[model samples]
Target: MKVTLERTDLLKSLTHVHRVVERRNTIPILSNVLLRCDGGQLALKATDLDLEISEQIPAHVEQPGATTVPAHMIYDIVRKLPEGAQVSLETSGDNATLELRAGRSRFALQMLPEADFPDITAGEFSHAFTLTGRDLRLIIDSTQFAISTEETRYYLNGIYMHTVTTDAGERFRGVATDGHRLARAEVPAPAGASGMPGIIVPRKTVGEMQKLLEDPDAEAQVEISEAKIRITTGNVVLTSKLIDGTFPDYGRVIPQNNDKTMLVDRDDFKAAVDRVSTISSERGRAVKLAISEGRMVLTVINPDSGSATEELAVDYESDPLEIGFNSRYLLEITGQLRGDTASFSFADAGAPTLIQDQGAEDTLYVLMPMRV
Candidate 1:
C-alpha cells in the first residue's frame, strides 16, 4: 500500500481512531490500527473488542493495499512531523513493515497482516435516527457526571437512554444515577426514533460519542438494537456493545410532592458550596444547607478541620429546612443549570431534594440527603 496525505488530514484521522486502541492488548493485533488505502481515501480503524471506531480521510493513493501498524506510534510520528508537510506511507508485497517518510524524517514500523484483525459484527439495527450535535451534547453533558462508577451495579455504569412522552409531547431522555444522586435531561425526540428500545450506553462509548459530537453544526446518524449501538458522522463511525443489564425505573426516585421551594442564583449557590466545602471532611465532603424565611446558610464542620460558613440570600418562604449533602454533588448539578436561577424543592431533611433550572424545565436533578 502506498498513500500520500497532508499531515493535518492524517493527524485528524488518527486522533479519532486512537481512542479505541488500548495501550496494552492481550492480542498483538488489537494494539494496531488497520489502514486500508483505495479509491483516493485512507481508512483507519481501531477496536478494543467491545468497541470499534473507524475514520476515513482523503489521501493521494499511489498503490492500493491494506496493513496494520501500531496505532499510537504512527499517530505520534505524523503529529510530530513538520506542519503542512506531505507524508508518504507504503509497504511492498514482500515486506512485513510499513515505511513512513516526511521531509528529512523516516521510520520503518512493523506491520501485521490485515486478515488478522478481528471482525466487528454490526447486525441490523432495529431503530435508526438522526440528531444534531447540539442535542446530543446537551444530554451527555447534563447526565454523564452522575453515572455510577461502581462495578457491582454494572447497570448504572452508563447513561440510560430512551424515549418518553412528556406533557408537552414526546422527547428523548438520558438518565444516570449512582444511588446518592441522579441526573435526568431530555431533548425532543428526533425523527425515526418512535418506539425505540431503551439502551444503556456504556461509559466508554458515552465519552467517545461525546468527542464525535463536538462539532455543533454536524448531524450524527444513530442506529441501535438491543445488543449494540452505532453512531456515524461524515468522517467516522463508532460501534459498541450495549451493557447487558436493565436500568432501574428512575421516574420512581424523583420527588413527587415536595411543595416547599426556593429559588437561588446558581452562581451564588455554587460559590457558597465551594467555599464552605473547604472545611468539609475528606471522606464525606459534606456541607449542611440551612434555609429559612429568605436566607440560606451553607456550613461545613470537620473534626480535624475548623468549621466554615457562607450565606446566600434566596427566595424561600416555607418553614426552615436543614439538609446535608455531598458538596461535590451539589456543585456538579448546579453547574449544569443553564439559567441564572436554580430552583430547589424540599420535603424535609430526610427525603431526597429535587433541583431544577428555573428557566429550563427539561432538566432535573435529585440528591439524597446525608445526616449531618
Candidate 2:
C-alpha cells in the first residue's frame, strides 16, 4: 500500500486505534495493526481478540493495497514528526517491510500478512440505538470507580446495563459494585432501547468508550447483542465482547430504611477527610466519623504515628452514631456529587451508608463501613 497523509490527521487516528493492541501478545498477529489504503482514505485497525477499534482518515492513495505492521512503533514515529509535515507510507517491492518517511527521517517496520489478522466483529446485532455523548459520559463517570478489580468474582468487573420502567418513565440504568461499595446512575431511556437484553459491559470497554466520547455534542451509535457491543462515533468504530458471567442483583445491597440523615457541605467534608487521613496507616487508611446533633468530628489514629482530628458543623438531627470508612473510597464517592450539599443516610455503625447529591435522586452510592 502507498498513501500520503498529513501528520496531524494520521497521529489522531493512530492514537485511538493503537490503544486496542496489547503490549504483550501470545499470538504474533495480535501485536500488529492492519492498514488498508483505498478510495482516497487510509483505514487503520487494531485488536486484542476481545476488543477492537478502527478509524478512517482522508489520504492521498497512490496504490490500493493492505498490510500489517507494529502498531505502537508506527504511532510513536508519527507522534514525533514535526507539526504540519506530510507522511508517506509505502510497502517495499520484496513485500516484507513498510517504509515510513517524513521530511528527513525514515524508518522501516516489519509486516505480517493482512490475512492473518482476526476479525472479532462478524456477527449480527439484535439492538441498535443512538445516545448523545453527554448522557453516555455521565453514566460511565458515575459508576466506573466502583467496578471491582478482583478476578475471583469476575461478574462484578464491569458495569451492568439494563432498562427499567420507573414512575417517571423508562430509564436506562448503569450499576457497578465491588462488594465494598455500589454506584447506580440512570438516564431517560432512548428510543430503540426498549426490550434490550441486560448486558455486562467489561471495564476495559467502558474506559475506551469514555476516551472516544470527548466531543460532548457528538452522537454515538450503539449496537449490541447477547455477546458483543459495537459503538460508532464520527470516524471511529469500537467493538467489544461482553463479560460472560451474570452480574449479581445489586439492588439488595442498597439500604432503603436508613433513617439518620446528615447534610454537610460537600467541599468541606472532602477537605476534612483528606486532612485527617494523612496520619492513617497505609494498609488500613481508615477514618472515623463521629456524628452528633449538629456536629461531626473526623479522626484518624496510627499506631506508629500520632493522631489527627477535625470537626465540621453539619445538619444532623438523628441519634448520634460513629462510623469508620476507607478514606480513599470516601473521597472518590464525594467527588462524584455535583451539588454543594452532600446527603448522607446511615443505618448504624455496622450497616451500609447511602450518599447522594442533596436534591438529585438520579445517582446513588452505597458504601460498606470499616471497623475502627
The C-alpha RMSD in Å for every predicted model, in order, reads 0.8, 0.8
lDDT of 2 by residue, 1-372 (tens): 899999999999999999988999989899999999999999999999999999999999999899999999999999999999999999967769999999999998999999999999999999999999988888999999999999999999999999999998999889999999999999999998999999999999999999999998999998989999999999999999999989988878999999999999999999999999999999999999999999999999999999999999999999999999999999999999999999999999999999999989789999999999
After superposition, which runs of candidate 2 have C-alpha atoms over 4 Å from their true positions?
A: none
Residue runs of model 1 more than 4 Å from their true location after superposition: none
Query: What do the candidate models score in CA lDDT, each in turn?
Result: 0.93, 0.95
Superposition error at 327 for model 2 (Å): 0.9
Q: How does model 1 score by TM-score? A: 0.99
Q: For model 2, what is the alpha-carbon lDDT of residue 347? A: 97
TM-score of each: 0.99, 0.99
